[model samples]
Target: MTQPSPHPTLTPQFCFSTVALRDFLRISRASIDDSITQNLNALYTPAGQGFDPSSTSVRAPRPQNSRQIAPSSCRAFKDQVLFPSWQVRSDVLNYCASVATSPDPDDPESVLRQVESERDRERVVNERLDPYSARFFPREARTEMLAAVVRQERSVEKIIRARSWGLVGERCGGDFREWEEAMNEWRKAREK
Candidate 1:
C-alpha cells in the first residue's frame, strides 16, 4: 500500500446552512445533562465508596481560621447542590409560562407598565412583612414603612434599568447610555 501523505490536508471552510441552531442547542443541553449526571455519580460514589457530604467528617487539626471558614464552605456546598437544579427548573418553567401568556409583541410599553405594576404590588406585600416592623408598629411606623418602600422601590427600579439596558445592548448592539436615554424618553411619554 502507498504510504499516507506526511502532512494531512486541511479542509476548506464549508458553509453549513443545513443545520438549525435549535438542533445545536438540543445537542448542547443533552451533553450538559450527561456531564452533570456523570459528575453527580462520581461525587456520590468515589471508587464505589459511598460518600455523603452530610455524613462526611473533616479530621484536620483545629485551627483558628477553621471556625470562620467551615460554616461558609459547608454553605457553599449546600447551595451548589440544592440551588442550581431548582433555579434551572424554575427559570425554564417561568420562561415557558411567560411565552405561553405573552402579550402583544407590538405593545412593549404595556408590558413594561404591567411589570412596574407587579413590582409595586410586590413592594406593598414586602412592606407589610418588613423585618424591622416585627415587634410592633412604633409611632413612626407609617413614616418608616413609607421610607422603606421608597428605598426598596428605588432598588427594584435600578435592577430593572440594569436588566433593560443589558437587553437593549444585546438586541441593538448599542451602549447602555443609549438605552438609558431611550428609557428616559419612554418614561416621559408614559408620564403624559
Candidate 2:
C-alpha cells in the first residue's frame, strides 16, 4: 500500500491582492505599536511583573560598565516612561473641584473665570498626553463628571437598597423606619 503518499504535503500560498496588502500593513503597524508599548512597559516594570516608579520600593537599576556587556545583562531597561494616566485624571479633577469650591485670593473676580482657565489647562494636558491616554481619558472628561455619574448611580442603588431594607426589615430584627420614628420621638423629648 502507498499509505496515501505519506499524508498529502501542504504548501503555503501568498496573496498579493490590494486587500491583503492593506491588511498586512495594518497588522504590521499594530504589531509595531504593541511591541513599542511592551518595551515601554518593560522599562517601567520588572520581568513578568508591573512596576511603578512612584511606589516606595524602587528597584536598583543595573550599573552600565560597557555598552555591549551592560545591554546584554540589563535587557529590561526601556526608554519609555509609563506615566500614571488615572492619577493624572484624578488630580486634574481634584484641582477643578478645589478651584470651583475654594475661592482664591488672586482672582476675586468670577469663580467661573478660574474654572475656565483650569479647563484651558485641562485642554493643554489632554493635548500633551499620549494617544492611548487621550483616547481613554480625554482632558475634557473631568473627575467631577465621573463623580456626578457615580452619585447618580448611587442614588439609584440607594432606592434599590431602600426597597431591599423594607423587605428585610422584620427579618433583620427591626425596620429602619421604626428606628427613625424612635429617634424622632427621642429628639422631641430632648427638645421639650
TM-score for each of the candidates: 0.24, 0.21
Q: Give the worst 10-residue stretch by lDDT in candidate 2.
A: 1-10
Model 1 regions more than 4 Å off: 1-138, 175-179, 187-192
Candidate closest to the true structure, highest TM-score: 1
What digit string (tens of lDDT, one per residue) describes model 2 on residues 1-192?
A: 000011111111111122432343334323332243333333332333355557657666653421121232222121111112112222333433444344334433446655766765676334455655434323322333434543443354345434433432322222346423533454466468
* Candidate 2 residue pairs in backbone clash: none
* Candidate 1 C-alpha error for residue 108, in Å: 41
- Candidate 1, residue 54: the lDDT equals 52
Model 1, span 108-147: residue lDDT tens: 2555566666765565334466765334322322223334
Error of 2 at 172 (Å): 3.9
Local distance difference test scores for all models: 0.35, 0.33
